[model samples]
Target chain A: MNFDFTDDQQAIKRTAHDFLADRLKPDKRRELAEAGSYDDGFWNEIAELGWPGIFIEEDHGGQGLGAVELVILQEELGYALAPTPFFSNAAAGFLIQQAGSDEQKERWLPGIASGEARGTVGVVSNGEAVLVPDADSAAVIVLVDGESASAVEAGSAEVESRDTIDSTRRFSRVSANGGGEQLGGDVQAGLDRAEIALAAELVGISQWALETAVAYAKERKQFDRPIGAYQAVAHRCAQMMLETEGARSAVYYAGWTADNEPDTTPLAASMAKAYAADAGWRVTASSLQVHGGIGFTWEHDLHFFLKRARTDGHLLGSARSHRDRVAELAGLSRAAATA
Target chain B: MDLTLSPQEQAFRDELREWLEKNNPGQEPSGEQDMFKFRREWQKTLHDAGYAGLSWPKEYGGRGATLIEQAIFNEEMARQKAPGLANVLGLVMGGPVVIAHGTPEQKERFLTPILSAEEIWCQGFSEPESGSDLASLKTRAVKSNGGWNITGQKVWTTYAHEAKWCMLVARTDPDAPKHKGLTYFLMDMEQEGVQVRPLVQITGESEFNEIFMEDAYVPDENVVGEPGQGWNVAITTLMNERAGLAFGSAVAVKLALGDLMDLVRERGLEEDPIIRQRVGQLYIEAETLRLNAYRGLTSQMKHGIPGPEGSLPKWQWSDINQALTELAMDIRGPEAPTVDERWTYRFLRARANSIEGGTTEILKNIIAERVLGLPRMR
Candidate 1:
């Protein structure tokens, strides 16, 4: 059993890494984040790269890949903390593709895949979705609330822009009010895929935070030698490595299960979401601790990552909610019944 | 990436599973000596089936299985709750070191007996003074006629009383640096001037012993590698001790977690949200450990040697096992302090999981210095 990516997958990852590194410099990301808006130029460039359609089927005017490939791009975007509509658009695509009717797929999949008419997805509770990313600009918005989802044309729904601590991407409070078409397919399957996608982004964010901490530890000296020489600092960095790597393992395995092992996806997706949600916050917070007072300032790029990690932990599903699901899926219910 | 086993691997697993199903010896008896004898017989059975030394080279009387195959072997054995081989130290560490660095004569003399369980082995690297800093060990070996005279103390030597050979490391050059003056030797444990005393642990068990060697003689041919290079040889043994064990340990943790879940249900605490959260966290950690191990294995298969990432699974395993046992006790409620036998023994024994092979602190140091490229404290 090989746990590494295939040659083609490796090439996709390297390409994404180099492309993001070149296009989304720290200053560029800071400019967009500070401006509280995304650059249409950057979104168009990513769309030209066909990343928005990386996992969409070729029949729908897309590249026809799998969840693994989609995660590769999402991870790179998270690492760069790039401000784009990629994730929201992709989330909508996954839901429509997996849970929509044939007519809904035909109408929305092509536009979502081409990145011309982007879509966004949000979880609804009590008829309102409080945190729908990119909803203001989405061509279509998919709102899901337990077992059922509805797709609404952006103009037909109410979308009020909301500012989150994570300004790298935009969010909105949405309400469709019975104005959209119902997606009557496997909604949980779509939600599971979306959870795995979020988990991958968290892995990327954790990796970035870990690398930033290690670099800072090696360069920042105190009382004579680099602070890393002290176990107090070094052990924190080590703990960051452990959490980041563990989240990574969980996310990658979940992505693979989504593509190859359908029956295991529900359990695997919740595990990934649960582990990565906690790990993202913990690793980034630990990295901030490693940088001391500087990490606390707005001038440092580390805060952006820390904020993104915190916000991401609450999006789609919180760690506690996913852990509850994991308990049920992993045989807690079965054990209780047997007892 | 494909997580499923290949056809050949599946076939290998099927064959081994069938064999085990037919010849499973079940559990060992109580008492230390009885368990040791039972394991020895089990090892003999494994040797006859060509299962002992599964990862050693074919030229050295082994099956020469691939790393994945060896991992599968470990996973299957642990899955079946099979008794461990009596010559574990010999097969995993001693024979591998000899095969990697021994002369033809040394290999011929040492390989077969270890597989057959005719000559059990124990390790002598740690001392009371040299627990974490193994290079500072005071065990000394001096030149003699056709042999070397060893004198010093070694603690935490498992199975020392039953072992026929001790894979000993001694300072051969007193004038050299602490790490450079060492030599690796296979000392005969039956010789005079050698003593083994059981060291009772917190669990009131003497699974480990202290070895006292006052001028114990080891013939010149007993050295596994060149003189004064014992540090590197010992490193090889430590690496072997860590490699490929993750899969087995992961399976064992999974089994323990299953039992804990059973206990949780049996205690009527399954409806407790806090208990459920704890169980869920343990389950996730256990899975993370297993997945990380597979990633490490893939890296090792590509790079020939495992990267510093190998430390991750060991650290994770210790935490998971400890947390799991503690949760079991918590579920046991007011009866936790009483001797419930299985859970109590496991709860006490798991305290050593982090301290035994390598302390969690030392593991963190390794990951920080080696994996994360942090500066060394020294």
Candidate 2:
């Protein structure tokens, strides 16, 4: 009945937290975000930690950790608001590992796992993936359309850089034009795992926003005392805490479901993604509200988090879409016969 | 993180589930007295099975279940929709308080009756004037004849009419501070000076009552702790009220959600996109509440003290339950206002969830001041 991390999982979380805090400090993150580029050296340093392969199979030249460990790393990445290709690469890894054929896995899993030749995944809509993160830099790209997915080498696809409000991560519009190998196994399973990962990231962003808001509320004074002493401000901060913790619980449960309870992963993942998508944006925006004018400016790091949260909310699926899926999975069928 | 029940926990749950399946008294008859009688009988059945006071120590005639087992017991009860025990307040708060703070003689006199449902208990903490700021209660207990005479008005007391004992908190010392001057007493409710009047709620049923105590007598032996230390003892009772209830409440929400989905389908509104989204959101919120409760339980087990995070599930549960009932009404559409017993009753009753147990505002304040270390509004 324990819902806490094991000793080993706790160690992984602590290590990731410390490493990200040291490696992707505010200055370094801001530098990369402003430049609209990731530092290759920084990416290499993360690769050295084996996080890129955190959930890939050991036989495929990677660490055979579960989704829980991947969630820990993604949460830290989101908290640091680091500018890297980690999420995109991991999304690709999940797709290829879960849905790729034996031969395809042999060809690409090693590269995706080792971090030497990375991959990215995007949801294809109307023959084009409109918001593919790190598509231009990936060695391979997995384009998912409904139940099916395909792996296309970067050179075989048309990748155009797309500037987004979140400059911390790069995005590209990708079109493979039927020039890729189709993944043969369960694509929705991989997508569910990816959604859980994204949800974990949102949880991290939410936690950061909540902490930032609480700290600011305590230190900032208005009229006679700290604004936090006022219920108006304090309750807003408390609501943020509620949402953040709720999102965290959902995401962690989804991650555990992915690793252990396969049958429940789809519903669990959608619940996580839906709750977190709303919570991530709401908490960050609330934090900005708490900061007043300072949070609105580009100079404050809070904007970066806010933008990232908004971008993440729409990346895999918006809250509305995932919620729609949840309704279907939960037996709210549109078919009249069922009703 | 392992969310699955352990082997022992699973066995315990299975045993209780089987027992409930066999001994389950299907449903309570409608009238308040009839329901109370039904529940009293059910509690007797549970006591015979050693299920009542399952969390109390073995020496006190309990199973001495671990926290997880107690949580399982709660979740299963809510899941099976089992009839609630007649001595809920006694089992949850009074028995635990007596065990923690009572004298040996007090334990011998109190604990067994609470388990057997021979004596039911009700709390007397909230007054009309001191609902949230409980320490400022005007309830006065004047010492005389090796006992005390209490006089005050207490509101929002559940089971007051049927209760044999009142876990009353009153001011025993007028000169001391508001918090320090209070004392906890096990006041006899059958006395001539004590009176209970039903407080009709929005649901038009009196699940709660306003207790009027005029010169209510309590022997000095009935004091659970030293006089002037009732505040701390009362805090223990409040903590007990909050603990081990999250799991049950979460399950209850899920069950209500299931009923809501059924209503949606029965009305052929399941296909409506707006209804679907609302239902989906409710499902997500329910899951979040359940998971957060599990996370809280794990942390409490590890730390041996529930943290401020404990405030979250109650707050979240209130929101989810209220939203769920409102959605049910919305799904009912033109039929929403029509008196449909179950859903209509639930819709009106849910308004008190955020206010009762602890208001959502107070919970937010606790999270802000205690959990986040924000400045207190004081």
Candidate 3:
């Protein structure tokens, strides 16, 4: 019943933390965000580390580590706020691996795994999957409409750039028809894993924001005392810890379930996603409130976290939708029926 | 992180489960004394099977269970809706304190009866005035003929009427500082100087009591640790209270939530979008509490004490349980306020969840000043 990372997992986390710290400095990340593009050098370095395929099967030209390892990387990357295609590519990788046909796996899984041909998954609505991250650069785009999924080559889809409030990553509007083979297996299971990945990222963002807020509260004094001594600011920080830890607990559990307890993954994934989406945005916003005026300025780095949190909360699914799923899956439907 | 138990832990759990199944005492009688007697008998049954004092070391007449086993024990007990042991305060706090700091004779005198439920114990830490600022308590014990004469009032004393021993803390040095002058004494509750008056709560139950200790006698041997070190001993008791309660509290909340879900389904509200969202949110909150508790338990096992996150589960449990009841009422719709249901009573009971343990506001202050490194307000 240990709820701690293993020694090997800790090593992976430390490696990711150190690499991102060294490579994705604040100025570098800001520059990439401003350009609305990922640096090829940074992308190539991450690819060299075999991070994209950290969770893909070993026989599929990649590492066979599970979702726990994948989340470690995603969380570190989120903390760094690095402008890379790691998340979108990993989202695509999850769908292809979990839901793709054997033929589709042979065609795209190798490239996605090796980071040679990066991929992204878009949730299709109204014949277009808007806000599809890295669609312009993605080689394969898996457009998901409900339980059905189809992998569309970037060349065959009409991809238009979609600017968003969060510049740390790029998004695109993609529409494809009469192209790309439909995923033959369970699309919902694949999406559940994807949602778990997003949830992990949200947890990371909240953790970063919380640390930043705590650091600021300790140093930023008012009335000849650190404002944190006042219950107003202090309580806010405490509440942030509560929310962050709550999201973290759910995310970590869901990540473990994805790898070890597949039968429980669907419900666990939705719960994690629902809790984290709200926590990710709320904690950062509260952190901003603690910082007060300086946090409102573009010059401060807190806004970046705030924007990322807001964006992540609505990425694959809103908290409301996930909560509804949780309601159904966690036994509310039966209760209501009997009622 | 592996959330599943190992083979050894699973074996321990299965064995405990089998024993519970075989020796299950069923429900307690309705009367207060009858319930207490029933619970004492149940504790005796547990003691005979070596299920009591699961966290104490083997040398101290306990199973010497690992932290995981202790957690599993709490979870299973909550799952089974087992009756609480008659000497809960002793098992959780008093025995541990004695083992940690008492003389060898004190352990011999106190530990076994606590396990067997032969001598029930209750806490006498809070007073009407001291409450959250326990060190500021005015309960004073003066030097008498080779013993101390304790004279003061203690409020919120649970099980005072049924208790044979009261784990009482009082001011031993009138001239010493508020926190430095105290002493912890194992006072005999079955004495003329001791009085226990039931303090009826909003729930219309006398679960707690107000005690007036008029020159209660306590020999020097009964003092825990040293004189003038009661604050530290009390802190240990409080920490133990918070750390050990999280898992049991989480399981209890989950059990309540399961019942509420049944109510939701019974009301045919599961198909309602708004109701579904609220229900789902509660489920997420409850699951988060459960997971965070396990994480906190793991941290405590590694570090020998709970981290700041350990302070969380109680606060979260209070909120989640309260919300579950409120949602049950909401699901009941126009019939919500009707006393025809169990949730109305549960909803009122949950109001004390935050206030009883430690006020939610006080918990925030602890997290801020101690955990977050915030400067103290001078």
All models: lDDT? 0.92, 0.92, 0.89
Cα error of candidate 2 at position A13, Å: 0.8
Model 1 chain B worst lDDT window (10 residues): B305-314
lDDT of 1 by residue, A115-204 (tens): 999999999999999999999999999999989999999789999999899989899999998789899999999988988988899899
lDDT of 1 by residue, B1-378 (tens): 999999999999999999999877998898999999999999999999989999998888899999899989999999999988899999999999999999999998999999999999999999999999999999999999998999999999999999999999999999999999999999999989899999999999999999999999999999989999999999999989988689999999999989998898788777788988999898999999999998898899999877656679888999999999999999999999899857999999999999988899999999999889999988
Taking the tens digit of each residue's C-alpha lDDT, what string does model 3 give over B282-370? 88998899899999889998998887788899899988888889888888889788885478889888999888879898898888888
Instruction: Flag the better candidate by DockQ, 2 or 3.
Output: 2
User: How many Å off is the CA of B96 in candidate 2?
Assistant: 0.4
Here, model 3's chain A TM-score works out at 0.97
TM-score for each predicted model, relative to the true structure:
0.99, 0.99, 0.98
Computed on C-alphas against the true complex, the DockQ of each candidate is 0.78, 0.86, 0.81
Higher-lDDT candidate of 1 and 3: 1
Write candidate 2's Cα lDDT for B198-284 as tens digits. Answer: 999988899999999899899999998999999999999898999878999999998998899889888878778898899999989
Candidate 2 lDDT score relative to the true structure: 0.92
Runs in model 1 deviating more than 4 A are: A334-339
For model 3, what is the error of residue B298's alpha carbon versus the real structure, in angstroms, after optimal superposition?
A: 1.4
